[model samples]
Target chain A: MEILLQQIVNGLVQGSVYALVALGYTMVYGILGLINFAHGEVVMIGAMIALTVLQILLAAAFAPVLAVLFSLLAAMAVCMALGYGIERIAYRPLRNAPRLAPLITAIGVSIVLQNLAMMIWGREYHSFPLPFSSTSHQLGGAIVNDVQVAIVVIALLIMSALMWLVHRTRLGRAMRAVAENPAAAALMGVDINRVISATFMLGSALAAIAGFMVSANYGIVHYYMGFMLGLKAFTAAVLGGIGNLRGAMLGGVLLGLIESLGAGYIGDLTGGFLGSNYQDVFAFFVLIAVLILRPSGLLGEKLAERA
Target chain B: MSINKSALLVAFGIALAGCGKSETASNPASAPAGELVIKIGAAAPLTGPQAHIGKDNENGTRMAIDDANARGVTIGGKKAHFELLSEDDQTDPKTATIVAQKLVDAKVNGVIGHLNSGTTIPASAIYFKNGIPQISPSATAVRYTAQGYKTAFRVMSNDAQQGKALGEFAARVLGAKQIAVIDDRTAYGQGLADEFVKSAEANGAKIIVREYTTDKAVDFTAVLTSIKGKQPDLLFFGGMDPQGVPMIKQLRALGVKTQFMMGDGGYTPKLIELAGAAAEGAYASLPGVPLDNMPSGRDFAKRYEERFHQPIQLYAPYCYDAVNVMIAAMQKAGSAEPEKYLPEIGKTEMDGVTAKIAFDEKGDIKGGAVTVYQVGQGKWHAVQTMGGAPAAKP
Candidate 1:
């Protein structure tokens, strides 16, 4: 019972991070109807920005909270600009050309972003400056730390803000209209290009939060750090139903829970016969099983473009 | 007509020969004039996940080449110059095999190569077949040295010692009754995991969980969840830093409060960053020469910083020493000729940056030590250097 409780708590925290990153994937797919493969790199960029700014801030002797805030804002701004730029230059050029064209371009864009990161950072592991990095607190016999708490709390806060921004603003309505019918909305004077750029900016800023949290939560990062995270978030988007915003979040969290639980329970039943290294495989196995059962997705609506 | 056509053909042949002769004569002396150049090959993962470490190894070799050239060392009673031709394997076995062939085709006198155990194991066969004496400063998989390759040797201790030391730490130091074990599933990960499991179990820690994960994975939630119920006293991971860091974060977040243990594969500056503060107080077994805390390491660190203008990567000093040992062996053999240095290479005891570099029978480094390190406040601090890895806690 205690063990189950621990896994659940842990999974929730892990799930939240995946969910935040997944939301960006789901939202961009909702608005643009395309998979922004570079979305993950944007998240990586966010983390890097946070890393660099914090280092500089700390060197100048700012308080921890101030440094974190400064870093967060800096990272968000950079990520938003990067997302807008990527969409405008890389995706916009080949948007109407062919389905394969944008995808291939996205791959090139991903590679280009990764290489750019490598050039700037010189292929070393960069650590973020996080407060309470040295403090561990006991929570009901479960050893919890400040970084994990920050990962969970900060991720949730970003999700709430994103939820509000997408649901409660004029721009949000414009975004929804664009997603529902880009051609029709453009005819209705919705500024299709501006709306699309705004969508990318908003989504990328949220992803930046994820990048910051994950790097701060985990402890180390590199240029190509976003590749696997992006792939997993895409899996999460699919699990919840592609283009479904809430569903993406749900999928990310559920995926995280399933992985932790599967590794813990299925692993033990194997009687040390199966080591803990296959935890990742266990998560994906669950994802495949879920996909086979649900087809479109767990929460994928049957109508209304599934957004 | 026939005489004119034949004459034209002859003229074309002469022109082609003239072009070829010029090309050969101009580039034949790639090095400066009046220098006896000795070519050496090094293969490393210059552009992959492990590239940072491999780059250090390559640069270390470069530094040695520079040092030797600058010293104006005489080889075969002739003033010999060294040239290091380094190739990027990108951490792929297939690429590494091709790179090894290319190096062999270049006819380098010796090599220091193939950082990864997965790449090194297969690529060494190619090097051995080509009769090139190769030394690896970082490849620590047990089978690498056990493969019976006369020309292949490593300056570092293998997984056997590394795993035993980690096992002992878990059983004796941690004093945990039940322990969970995991690996990254690479040759290095699995080998070290096996060694730890054997020693940990023998030391009376009930091995509760044993699982595997790929290096590319970021989530261990399922594995951690399963281990949570078992309530293992310790969670041992036999993997490198990339996996270890993220795994630590997930473990802490998932509320799996088990203490973490790992082999030298987990020791890197990034692990502290990857796991953030979570990695604080975690221990790992680094089986090899403890050069970082040594006087030689300190001096080498200064020299390296001065040369590279950056902090050296984890195994930089070791590779630097590997070159020194190879060059010293060449000097001992009294010739730079491959045949002369081939047999005498095994009988070297040169003072190197990592250690007094010497190899025993079976191509194992003689008198290697295992050092234990702990992550403290986002930095690595060496705790103890054990003479030989004790057999688990027992």
Candidate 2:
């Protein structure tokens, strides 16, 4: 029972970051009908940029809080800029072309960003400096650390803010109109390009927070860290009903919980044939099961035409 | 316009080739009379996470070549000029095999790496088929030499020795009755863990839980928590520094308080730097004497620092020894030809920076020493040196 509680806590922390990253994929998919496959790379850029800033600040002996704050802001600002540029230069050029073109281009952009990061950061694991104490608190027999709490809380806050912006704001309405029909939205003076660009920036900013969260939570970062994470988050987005905002959150958290719980008990269930090391298999297993059983996701609304 | 750009690109490519050729041409001893240039191929992961260790090994080989040239070593009555033809295998098996073939095609007399066991095991066959000698400075998987490939050799103790020593150390010295073992499931990690478990059981320490992880994974909360429930007193991980650092951090965060131990993969300064205070009291074992404790290690470290501007990493001294041993065989056989010197290599016996360099019948370092270290005061301090003999159960 204690182990289950511990895993639940672990899953929630991991899932919140997945949900945060999934939001970027879902938002971009909803607004522009593109997967923005490079969304994961954007998250990596955010983490890497923040790490560089933090390195410099720590070297200068800046206060831990000040350094973390500045670095967080830098990561967001840089990733937002990158998102805007990526949408304009890569996705925009192929917006009216066959969807496959943009999909391939997104993949291309992801590879280019990964190699660029490798060149910039080198392909080694770097220890991420934590501004706050990593000490855990015992709560109901479960271990909870400040970093995990911060990740979960910050992710929730970002998701809430995103929910508000997407539903209650003018940009959100414009984004919704564009997602409904780009030609019609343009006729209605919705400024389709602007909405798409805004969506990318907003989504990327969320990814930036998630990037910092994951880097801080694990206390390690590397060039290729974003690839597997991005794949998982994309699966989460799809599982939540690809174009549904709330579904992405549900799917991400659900996937995390399943993975944690599954990994925790797999050895016992299998009588030691399989072990916790195969935990990653649970995420994909859930993905495949969801895709087969509920094509539109648990909360996703069925669309007559697929994006 | 396209034609002109194509022409310009061609010109640029040619100019780059010429520039490369010029540097080689500038080498003072290239094809000089009475000088037989022997190209020794070195393959390792020079570009991935393990690149630091790979480059360290390459640097060791480089130092050996420089020293050999300076000594004007002769073979078959000709002054020998050694050249290191290095390639990055990128820590991948397919790449390692390709690199091995490329080295053989380049007609290298002897080869020096393919660092990880996953890579080295596959690449060893390529060297064997071509009758070229290859020595691994860091690959410690027992299966590496067990393949019966005469071309395969290593300068350090294999995982069996290291793992048994670790298990015995934990059981006898630390007196831990309950132990939990976690491996990354790679050939090196799993093989090491299996051996550790065997010896631990033999030493009367029962392994309570055996978990597994992957090389690239950083999250261990689930696995660690599962192990925590078992309440094991000692937690051992069989993985490299990258995963070990974070695992240790997570373990401490969970407040398990289990004594942490790892194999040679976690035995690096980088691990200490990454794990921070969490690494305090953590134990790690290396397959050879600590670099500082080696006979000529101090001088080699000073020279390596002067040359590379970085302290010697884990495998540099072993690599230096491997290279010198290869050259020694060449000198003994009176030729730098692989087939001629290969037999002499098997009979190698000389003082090396890492040990008294010699190989058992299986081509593993004979009676290779294993040194167990514990992180104390922010540094890995050698606690005990277990000689080549396997630890006896007490």
Candidate 3:
């Protein structure tokens, strides 16, 4: 029972980050009808930027909390600008071309960003210097650290804010309008490009937070860290119903739980034939099962003709 | 549509032409007139997680070549201009094989690396088939030399030796009755863990649980949580510092206070730097004595740091020894060609910075040493040295 609780806590912490990154994918997919594959790189860039800022501040003997706050804001601001720039430069040129062009360009942008990060940060894994030490709390035979708790709380708050923005605001209504039909939204006096760009910036800000949470929790960051994370978050978005905001959140948490529990108990479940190393396999297997059983995902609506 | 098709064809044609030009450019003619250019190929993971150690190995090899050139050695009555051709194998077995073939195609007189056992084992075959001698500075898997490949040699001790030392230390010195073992499933990690388990069991320490992960994986919570339930006395990991640092950190975070121990892969300054306080009291074993204790180690490390602007991570000294040993074999045989110096390597009896270098029949270093270390005060302090020849009089 204690092991189960521990795995659940682990899963939740990991899943929260996934959900945060998945929001970026789902939001862009919802508004622009294009999967921003490079969103993961944006997250990596955020962590790298924040790390640099934190290093400088801490070296200058700045207070830990204040340094963290400054770094977080810098990361979010840069990522917002980056999100706006990516849409403007890469997607805008291919907006009128074939759908495949933009999709391929998203992947191209992801690769370009990864190489650029490599050149900037080098390939060595930088140990994230934590300003504050992680203090553990005991909870019914399971242990939870301060950083884990912070990650969960911050992710929830960000996610809740995103939910409120997309549903309860004028910009949210405009975003929904753009998602419904670009031509119709334009006729309705919705600036399609601006709404789309806002969606990306909003999602990217969430990505920056996710990146910070990941580096803080894992205590390590590298240029290639974003690739696997991006892939997993994409899987989460698809599992939750790609364009559905709530579905992305649900999928991310579920995927995280499945991976953690599978990794924890796979040895016994298979009578020791398989080990916890098959943890990644459990995630992809769940994805395949979901795709086969429910093509539209658990909460996804039926396919609608876009053209 | 027709215009797009033509444009694509033209682009494809240009790409093919570009490839052809680069291929020819890479195949430079050997022996540029008078000076005999002795090309030595060095392979390591130059751009990935292990790149730090790989770069160290490359730098060590480059330093040896530069030193040899400055001294201007004569090989077979020709003034040899030593050239170092370094390639990034990216720590992948497939990439290592491709790199091996590329080096062989370039007709390198000798080769010095492929840092990981997973890579060295596969690439060794290519070097053997091409009649090129190869020396690995860090690969410790017993399977490497056990393949009976005359072309394969290593400066460091094999896993069998290091594991024995680690197992004995864990069982006898640490007095851990129950142990849990984990490996990254790489050739080096798995082999080292297997050897440790065997030796530990023989020493009466029961291995309660065995878990495996990949080199690329960062999360080990599930593995740690599972191990936590068992509550072993000590947890031994066999993997590089990249995975090792994170694993130990996560283990500590989960409140699993089992004593942590790892092999040479975890014996680096980066491990301490990355793991922070979590690394305190953690144990690691490395082949050969501590760098400060080796003959001429202090001088070599000082020169290396002066040149590279960084402290030696791990294996740089071994790499330095391997290159010098290979060059010494060439100098002894009076020829840079592999066919001439290949036999001389087996008969080597030179004193390297790391050890009194000599290879047994199997190309394993004669009496190779292994030193166990524990991190305290944010640095590794050597606790004991096992096997190998006794420390020579300074």
Candidate 4:
């Protein structure tokens, strides 16, 4: 009972973070039809930048709330510029080449960013400084900390705001147009380049927030922190239907819940033959099952042939 | 087309010249006449999560080489100018083997590290095959020394001794009856935990549950939550501080008030800094007596801090001792060759900053000590010292 409840809470908080990162992959996939593998590095950069800024501000004895806000904005701004630069420098030049070129370039960009980060930050894990001591609140029998609650609430708000921005704004319409057909969108005076770049900036901004949430939740950040997370979030995106916004969100949360619940119950399920250390296996297993059963994902639409 | 061809030719010529320059740089002809440049290879995870400890090992080895050179060591009546060739294994076993082979191929006179037991065990085979003496400063898995590899040696206590001390302390000293154990599933962590469980159970403490996690994992919520349900009186984790810090933090966050403890892998300044408030009252066992109690330990620590501009992390003193012991063997044998000086290491008996350096038949340190430390007011304080000589004022 309480174990189940505790697992659910854990799953939800973790899932929300995955969903935020998944949106970056899904948005880029939707707009450019290219999997921006470097998106994960963008999240890492965001966290690193935010952490550095926060540390400096805190050392200067700034207010905690204001310091957090300033650091987040700084991270978002840097990530936005980075996303734009990556698309311009790496992808734009290969736009007319074979699809594989851009895909490989995305991986190259990711590697470059990772090594660059390692060189700049070194390899030690930096502890995320918390302004307030995390106090746990009990619900029934499970414990929920202030950080976890903030993560869930903030993620929900940002995700909802994203939903509104993508569906109800002029930029959203342009983005949808660009995703539908860049040639057609350009013909319709959509300015395909601007729409694409905007989509990337928007996604990167979300990635920055996701990075902050991850560091805050886990209380530690490292140069290699983004790789596994990006891989998992990408998995969540694919499980939700790679190019679908709602599918990505659903997949992220579902994957998180599945991981937490699977980890929580695996010991009992296997009769102690396996342990929670095999937690990673559950995510991939469910991915394989989902891919085999529903190729288009739970909420993904059937692929449409374009003329 | 001709311009492009000439440009290509020029670039090729420049690349060849660059290679030639490096070749000349490493050429022994550049050394002063009658001076033998003896290369000592050091391998450790110099670029990953364990980089801090790895760098500490490298720095200690470097300091030893510098000191040896300053003293103008002579081997076979030749003035020996010691040179350090450090390689980053990134804490990966595969990389460790590659680094070991690289060191052997470079014809290094001796090897100083390959820090973790997981790395050291695999790399030891490579060193053994090449007949190169390898000394580990911190690899404490009992299997490392028990492998019958004469080339392998360590300066610190093995897991068998450390685990027994930890187990006895948990049951007898702390009086924790119900205990939960978690290991990172690495050779060192798992081996230490297994030994700990054996001794703890033998001491009449009931083992409630055992769990495993990877060294790379940052979150332990699910595992801690599950363990919380068991309501164990104490949770003991056998892993490095990178994982241990988060496990303890997450354990506390889950509102579990169970006592937390870990093996030497958790006994690092980084643990206290990262774990912060969560680290309070946490117990960890570190092999060897406290630095303040060692002969010349305070002086060595002062010199190390002055040189490195940072306080000594765990195992630096041991690393310093391992290098000096290897060099001492070379001096005793009157030759720098591994085969000639290898036997001298077994016969070694010298006072090190950590302890009186000596090796048993298995190449394990003789009479190695283990000390249990508890974090209080954000600093680790030694609560109990087990085995080895009585504390001597530095």
Candidate 5:
């Protein structure tokens, strides 16, 4: 029972980061109809920014909490601007062409950003300072961390605020209208460009926060930190139903839980019996089972997008 | 009949003249310029997971070649510069095999390395077949030295010796009768962990639990907590510093206060930075500090800092020593021919950055020391040197 509780806490903490990143993926997919492959790179960029700022604050002997806040703000501003710039130069060029053109452009942009990060911050690992996240919390016989709790609450709050904005605000209406039908929305006097840029900015801001969160959680950052996280976030988005807002969130949390549990309880036995090197096989196998059981995700609609 | 005989004689004379022109062999004086440049083949991971260490190791070899040339080492009374022909195997065994074939085709006089044990194991066969002497600075798996290849020699202490030292430290000194073992599941990682467990068990310490994490793994709370439940006196890890640092930090964060111990892998300065002062209590075992402790090490540290703009790690000096040894062997043999210089390597006892490196018949460096270390107040402090452990006799 104790083992199960500890594993659950571990999964929840990991799941929260995935959920945050997946939210950005789902948001962009819903509004722009693009997978936003570079979204993960934006997360990496955010991490780099935060790491740089954190180091500066640390040099001055600032408290860990204050330094973290400053890091998050710097990371968010830079990553959001990066997202806007990418959309303006790369995505905007092929917006009117075939979807394939933009998809290819997104991939190219992703590689460009990754290489750019590598060039700036060599291939060495950078350690981020986070005082708040380092402290753990044990409650009701369950072990957890303040950072894990913060990630969960922050995701919930950001998601709530986003839901309200999309359902209530003028810009949100424009985004929804554009996603539904660009031609009709343009006829209704909505600037498709404005909506798309706004969508990217929003996603980028969330991704930047997530980037800081993950680095703080993991305690190490590097140029390629976002690559694996991005792949997994994209997987989570698909698992949640490509364009469904809450589906991505659900998928992200579920995937994290599965990985932690598999790694904790049975990975040793399984890895020993078969091959320890391929330990991730069990959790990913669970993911396949989930996909088979529910093709479009647990709460996602298989036919809604086409409808 | 006379006309036919005259035509046959003329044709036969013409054919003989053509053969005479083609067969006019050049005399010793007329022979083209005779030159042989000594080349050493280097196979290692220059592009993948261990790229940093691999590239640095190759650079060490390159530096030795430069030093040798600057001193004008004579081979058969002609000045020859050592050349390193390198290929990136990306740490893959299959790619290492291909790179080995390429180096064999290039006909290098000697070989430097294939850094990781996994790649090194497969690549050693190519050098054995081609009669090239390979001096590895970093490969430390127990089986690596057991292959009975006459040419294969590593300057550093093997992983088994490291594990034994660490295990003994935990059992006899720390008095940890029950311990938990963990590994990263790679060849070097698992192999070393197995050794530590075997030795620890033999020394009257019971392995209460064993868990594992991989490279790039960020969290080990579940595993740590499980071990905590077992209430072991120490946590022994068989992996590089990547996960090792975080495992220590998380073990503290989760309030599991068991002593943490590892092999030469956790001795890097980066692990100190990652784990911070919490690393102070951590224990590790590795090859002893080089022969010239004060001036030579200080000189190396200063030179390395000036060149690379960062502090050199534990094995960098050993890497420096290896290339020096190879070049010394080349100089003494009086010929760059691999067949001639390989036997010369067996009797070499030159002063080097690490130690006075001299290889025995089985290619194990004689009189090397393995030292134990503890992270004391955010610094890795050497405790004692462990001697007389038999180097592998193949």
Candidate 6:
């Protein structure tokens, strides 16, 4: 049905955003073996900063393209700095300590960043400026917008670039070496601290782009925007195999498609007893089902314990 | 021992007297000028997504207080000076209760507040328990006035009136046969949407699809796509401007050309700015006469704009009226105390900036007005203004 195709388009657009944010989660977890809870906050920061920059530029009568370009770059730069700071101050000290310490610290960092953003932005929903035209192109009764197209294309490009960075580069090998055995990697003259910091920077930059794209796609931004999104992205990472790069991407896109289609059809399917508002329930159900059926994730390989 | 006990009792009495004296003395309004200082606590979402509207409400209260002070209002032969104690509820119900208690503890004579129904409903209980009269500038949920709390009062029309008007308009004015309704699922949004659906159905418009979303949600593709499949002639959303803006944008982006309808929450200049070209032809219903039609509205808008450096959002004029109506009650009763003036509040008749302010027994504005607006040429033009139960659309 055309409606089904339309839902898929919508799902893919949403899925790409989730996949982008999920990559941030999986990468940090892959390299650090610790969930960087603050990564979502970085996403929030990115969106807020981008919106603020765009507003400033627009107020100054700058071209929309120039404003958007500057905004994205500013968001990336600021988020990268924030990511580095979070790692250096919050996680680095606790790297060898109990895992729970860093995890709790990451949560603390998230809360702190959220409150900080609220204080700065004044806790209001800001309408993000649409740099591109919002005109819709119809394809067989389905609608597509420039923002959606941009999100999907950019997400794929980022994922491909990330795949290459993680698999084909010398730094990529060093990152894998560090992940496999930090003690041995350091003994072999790899800068474990530098590698970990680089991973955080890379993950934060990806999240920043995701944050910017999500804001552009939604056409709105606010302080608490990242909380639910971060949770969903984390679910995607887990569903795709947390440390498995490709799995995260696959999981995120799949989750997005399922949620969109499920929400689209659930009301009619249920004789109006349930509505699309229950869409979140379906997303959570996927998480629960995935956890039950494949705890190692769809593409995750079971790693043997050290002797 | 007896002498020491007597001394202690004397000290305690002196301390009690000192407290009462200092309370009056320290209040800048009292200032030992035989002035009766009435502290009116105003609570709203002064720090959240709703802060812009909250600030508008607070500014209205401030303007009224300024006017009252300029007029040198006197009650029972005492010069009455009004002091506004503003608190931010942060748009949270729990925070609203805490803010309500804080205002009560501050011993405010009256309260004007709590922009949202969710905040106002819970906070009303606190004011009622403390015998403090509370007037909401914008809380329009029917249950707010229906709660049997004499302390609760609102200057604007409730959802029942606004929704009915919107529904009738959609059916009669737009001549829509099939309609789809969506709500943000907040107390205000759901309540307004329910009333609209009820009245729309009553007016012979068949609802094809009903969808619900949270106030924070921005993406509406799936929901709109489903609604699009049904091919409704009209789409009604019961939510604030923030959600309405994006929803409309997304709807248009998806090529759904159904005539969009919204309640007062979407009836703002900000909505136009946010939705841009997508806001064209959208219908929104705001409670009360348009500002241009009000006798004092033009002057009030000018003064408000001059003071705030921003155009008035929705509810500011009503807020201005709410404060004056409360002051009118105090003047009628010849007293500034809550217990004395609370009864007089129901009997008030004041020509305020918004309307002839008076409350029915249910604490709702008597014969509250609803104005229907259509966005034309990138501006809101009032198409109709109806009072009482709207007359079958036409």
Chain B, TM-score, each prediction? 0.87, 0.93, 0.92, 0.92, 0.84, 0.90
lDDT of 1 by residue, A1-307 (tens): 6677667766777788889889888888887778889888998989998999988999999998999999999999999999999999888877677677888888888888887887788776666657644476777766566777777787778777878877899898898898888888999989989988988888899888889878776667688789878888888888998888888888989877876666667655776666555556655776687678885677876545432
Interface RMSD of 2: 1.6
| TM-score on B-chain, cand. 3 | 0.92
lDDT of 2 by residue, A1-307 (tens): 8888999999999899899999999999887778889999999999999999999999999999999999999999999999999999899989889989999999989988987897798756678987667777888999898888888888888889888988899999898888888888999988888888888998899888889988998788887788889989998988899989999999899888888888888887888889998888887877898899998888888787744
DockQ of each: 0.35, 0.58, 0.69, 0.68, 0.16, 0.45
At residue A276, candidate 6 shows an lDDT of: 89
For each candidate in the order shown, give its overall lDDT on alpha carbons. 0.78, 0.87, 0.89, 0.89, 0.75, 0.86
lDDT of 2 by residue, B48-165 (tens): 5677678788889888988898888988898889888888898888999998999899899999987788889999999999999999998889999999999999998999898888
Model 3's lDDT to the true fold?
Answer: 0.89
RMSD of 3: 3.4
Q: How would you encode candidate 4's per-residue C-alpha lDDT over B138-233 as one tens digit per residue?
A: 998999989899999999999999999999999999999999998999999999999999999999999888888888888788888888889999
- What is residue B84's positional error in candidate 3, in angstroms? 1.8
Tell me, by DockQ, which candidate is best: 3
In terms of lDDT, the poorest run of 10 residues in model 4 chain B is B20-29
CAPRI docking class of candidate 6: acceptable
Model 4 interface RMSD, in angstroms? 1.2
Model 1: runs farther than 4 Å from truth? A132-157, A160-164, A290-295, A301-307, B1-30, B47-49, B105-107, B165-178, B201-205, B217-234, B245-260, B267-282, B292-295, B309-312, B331-340, B373-394
Error of 3 at B203 (Å): 0.8
Q: Please say which candidate is ahead in lDDT: 2 or 3.
A: 3
How many angstroms is residue A244 displaced in model 6 relative to the true structure, after the best TM-score fit?
Answer: 2.8
lDDT of 6 by residue, B41-124 (tens): 888876546777787888888888878888899888898888878888887889999989998999999999889888899999
TM-score of chain B of 4: 0.92
Decoy 6 TM-score against native: 0.90
Candidate 3 vs. true structure, TM-score: 0.94
Top model number, lDDT: 3
TM-score of each: 0.85, 0.93, 0.94, 0.94, 0.85, 0.90
Model 6 lDDT, residue A227, Cα: 82
User: What's the lDDT for residue B170 in model 3?
Assistant: 94
